[model samples]
Target: MFDSRHIQTFAEVVRTGSYAATARDLGYTQPAISQQMKALERAAGTPLFVRAGRGLRLTDAGQVLARHATGILSTIATAHGQLKAITRLESGRVRVCAFPAANATLLPATVARVAASHPGIRVELLEEEPPDSLRALREGRCDLALAFSAGHGGDAAEADGDSDEGLVEMPLLDDPLMVLLPADHALAGSSRAELGELEQERWIAGCRHCRGHFVAACAEAGFAPDIAFATDDNLAVQELVAAGAGIALVPGMTLPLLRHTGLVARPLAPAVGRRVSAFVLEGHETAPVTALLLRTLSEAAADMERAASGFPRSEA
Candidate 1:
């Protein structure tokens, strides 16, 4: 019920034995210190100070309060410190959900940067496809979700209206889709190729969304893909492509992970790629963890996209 400022002034008065000195030390007028002392005495229901000529002396009540004030002031100072720490991003927890390829590529980089920079902010990652990840975000099981949308003018945020309200998106990177072909394939000699050019080749597709996008892109190019295989496993897809079973379209982020010998990755044109974005509730972007997560995620994806251009040709 008592003001911390008054308690602080009481302790200072007891320390200096003069209201003028307390005021000088605390940047208040002597009259203000005297008034505060009166108020403190009123709150305590007893006189806490007595005039001893040129200085002040403590009454028995004042002695008891001064004794307890030390601990009281210590507790108050500790509380103030904790409150201030909240203003700083010293600690926070962010639950993050990401798509499969993002989990393999961007999540590591994002978590690394977060650990190196904001070590106090804990990051939890969930590996899910865009649909499930976005669903979890809407369901409040996650603080941020990393998702993608197919070629829609390079901005997944607006492209994936996903038919949701109060969900905001931050566009992070555009990961161009790559064509994975066996080295012996007739088109492998070229560094780039068009989606339409491969219309006649047997196709390898992954995840429902990936297959749907590939088929839609093929339709746009005036052809239907002959998808002879459908598997979400990136390695299996690469193995099939390497064995000359069929060609595939995979994200640029997955390009570096392609390990099969005789597999060549070439950028598709008229360029096809997914837009990587961070999704959060409309106002949670300002949260410390979400803001930090968004910043780190953007930086990680940007770095990955920049490095994607330099993918080792010898391995691709």
Candidate 2:
């Protein structure tokens, strides 16, 4: 009989590309990881890995076994979560990671809804850039990650490259992109702002990803912007816009937070939006707390959109 623990160790080694790294992640020594792999190979009477240049590559048999191991481990995890939820011990910890703007706006409501629904479940929030949030989900540091990317005109183009294995993404909401300007600015009274009209004004760029997104949107309208301020902090970007430092492309969900003495948000004329998405490492979907949290987040986002449009939302 194959030891599930040995199978897990072997899978980790393959996923991490080195026994040393796998050992560090699993809290075992390098020698221990090697011994576990060797023992598994001995039991199966076959070599699982071949030495590559400074690393290891899975043999055909190893590749097959690793895949099976991953699935088996995931199934076990799901079963355990189900059993835990069944006995009314519906308590478990989940970490959520997201970008600053998302953290500032969507997360508070999502957390509130989850807390009301699952009083026993504990959720800890981690602030990270989108790339790091996705990484956290892949590496098991976070159970779920809230990630966002520009809407590809309603097509399902994922925000980042699909490098993380066994991951799934669900679109939560379409947050309309808006132009935030000084309250007394000439364009503040306008119902909508065209991308081309802002070409001569100083602009605040959020992060590299955000900058790229804005630049691409402007290119669609025939100009590249002159960035006067660049920051990873969404609040700072809004503060700069409020202080008349420069204008910014702010998301609609963020408008409520930025409603201030010196700022006004106007929808874009061409109507570009970004989709906020929920990510879960696949096979962990049946975890009750995680599932409930995901459902609450999706419903909260829809409620926010409805509220913004002055539509009646059912009681929360």
Candidate 3:
């Protein structure tokens, strides 16, 4: 039987990318970690890692083993929790990563609520873009990831099957695009504005995906928008609009999060909204705590929608 110690050593080496780093982290002598890796290779009857300069690279065989090892170790840790405790509220950790807008809006409330309800569960929140969050979730660096995509209204990348291999995505909410203008703009008091009315106005552009949303929404309305400034930060976009640099089509949820004195938000008459979803690795679904968190987050999103509807109408 392969030793647990050897498996742990291999995992540490793979994570740190160096035997010396692994030794420092694990507080073992460097040679001891190396010997454990050798033992692992011998048991498997194949090379798991290849020497690369002063570090090591996982051989194809090693990559496969590392993947399984990550799952196995996580399972073992969870099993221990299951045997020792009934409620995950007592002690555990949930790693969450999402894009900035989510971090600014839904995430803080969700995390704060979770932390308050389950003081024992450590909630580690990270601000990461979709690509990085997806990568982190697949590699076991995060327990859950919040993701967004521009659906029919924009040019969305074809969904890659491998992009969700080990994870199951749950649809959360659809956020429609809303136009943000200077509070004194002629159309700010209107319930909704048609895309064509703003065609000639300079635009404060969103990120690549959101830019697709604005550009496509306008194209559908028979005019191509003139984006004068492109920025990833929604707050910055609102600031630009307040400064009278231009206008922008931002997500509905962003109205509450982006605080700007001179900006007013109004939905487009024919709305375009992006779909947002939460994903958790497949095996984690069985854990009661993970399930609870998912349920709570979904509920929070529903509340956010209601809050969006109640926002005070701004006037020009």
Candidate 3: global Cα-lDDT? 0.79
Question: All candidates' TM-scores?
Answer: 0.73, 0.68, 0.69
Tens digits of per-residue lDDT for model 1, 1-316: 7899899999999999999999999999999999998998899999998889999889999999999999999998888886565447677688999878888888998899988987777888887777678888988899898888876332333434555477888989987888888888887888789888898999999887677778888999999889899998899998898888999888889887877787888888788887788999999999777888888888887788779767775455
Q: Write out the backbone clash pairs for model 2.
A: none
Residue-wise lDDT of candidate 3 within 221-272, one digit each (tens)?
A: 7898887899997767877888899988887777777667877788877776
Tell me, by TM-score, which candidate is best.
Answer: 1
Query: What's model 3's lDDT at 186?
Result: 94
As a whole number from 0 to 100, the lDDT of residue 46 in candidate 1 is 90
Cα lDDT over the full model 1: 0.84
Worst 10 residues of 1 by lDDT: 152-161
Steric overlap count per candidate: 0, 0, 0
- TM-score ranking, high to low: 1, 3, 2
The lDDT values for all models are 0.84, 0.79, 0.79
